[model samples]
Target: MSADHYFSADPAAPARPGTVEFSVAGRDYTLAVASGVFSAGRLDTGTAVLLRKAELPTAATGGTLLDLGCGYGPIACVLATEAPSTIVYAVDVNARARELAAANAEALDLAGRLRVAAPDDVPADVEFDEIWSNPPTHIGKAGLHAMLERWLPRLAPDGVAWLVINKNLGGDSLHTWLAGLGWVVSRVASQRGFRVLRVARKTA
Candidate 1:
C-alpha cells in the first residue's frame, strides 16, 4: 500500500471535492471534503457511529479537547459547535487534511475556537481535557498502537478519551492491550459490529 493512505504528510491524488451532511444534537453540518483525505466521499460510518453512540460534550463543557486524526474537521467542528467556549484542537498528519480542516472551521465561523495543526505543531506542554477519535486502524496494530501511545499520555489528569473501533479489526484485543497499559478501558457501546471504547487514565 502507498504511504499516501490518509496519514501521509502530503497526498498526490487529484482533489475531487464534495460535501458531507450530518446532524448532531439537532445541529446540522454540511462540510466540504475532498480526495486525499480520510473518508473523502462521505461521513464515514465508523465516525457517524462514534458521534452517535458516544456522549457528546455539552455547552457547559469547557476546556481543551483533542480531535485526534481529525479528517476535514468534522469532529472538531461538532465539538466547537457543542461547546463554543472550549478550544478544539484538530490534529492530523496530512497537510491536505489540515488545510481542509482549517477551511471547514472557517466556513462554520468556528475559526476562533478551532485550532488546526499538524501533529508536531501542537505545543508539547498542552494537555487535553478530552480526546475523541475514529482512529486509522488500517495502519495495522503496531502503527495504531504507537500512535495512541504517543497521544493518550497527553490526556490531562481526570480526562477521558472516547474511541470507536471495528470489532473485526482487533477491537477487543485493543481494549485488553489498553488495560494492560494501565488505562481504565471499558466498552461503552456497540453497534453494527463497531465497538465504542471509553478510556481514562488510572488514578494513582
Candidate 2:
C-alpha cells in the first residue's frame, strides 16, 4: 500500500508529471502537476467543488488571502489571477507540494502576488483578508479541528473563509463546532456530495 499521504513532508513516490485543466468563473487553467503531491493526476474533486461553489475574490479585492494546505497552487493561482491586487499566501506542510505550488504560481505569472511557504514560515502577525481551503478530512476529526483552531483565528475581523468538506467527513459537525467556537458558519452550497461552508467571526 502507498504510505504517501498528501501531508507527507517529502513524499517518496516517484514523480510522475502531468497536467490538470479546470475552469472557474469562466477562466480556464492548465496547471503542471507531478506525482508525490496531492491530486497529482487531476484537480482534486474537493478543490474543484470549493472553487465552483465558494465566492471568489473580485478584481478590486486588495488584501492578503490565505490558501491553507495549498497542494499545487490551484487556489492561490486562481486568487492571484482573479484578484491581481491581492497577495496570496499558499501554505502547506509538505515540502514537495510547496515547491510545486511555487512553480505553478510562477508559470501562471502569479509569483509576484503569490507567496508559497510552509505553515510555520508564515509570519505570526499576518492576518488574512480571506482564507480558502479544502482541508484533508482523512486527517481525522481531531486533527481537522486542530488545524481549524490554528488558522481560523487569524482571520481579520471582517474576513471570511471558504471551505469544502465531504458530507461524510464531519462537515455538518464541523459547522456546529465552528459555531461553538463563536464563528458564524453557514452552509453556502452543496453539490456532488460535498458541502461548501462560509465562515466568519461572530459579532457580539
90-137 per-residue lDDT for model 2 (tens digits): 999888889889999988899988999999999999999999999988
Q: For candidate 2, give the lDDT of residue 4.
A: 69
Q: Give candidate 2's error at residue 177 in angstroms.
A: 0.8
Q: For candidate 1, lDDT tens digit of each residue in 1-204? A: 886678888998878888989988899999998888999888888888899999999999988999999999899999999998899999999999999999999999999989999999999999999999999998899999999999999999999999999999988999999999999999998998899999998888
The alpha-carbon lDDT assigned to residue 144 of candidate 1 equals: 95
Tell me the lDDT of model 2 at 165: 93
TM-score of each: 0.97, 0.97
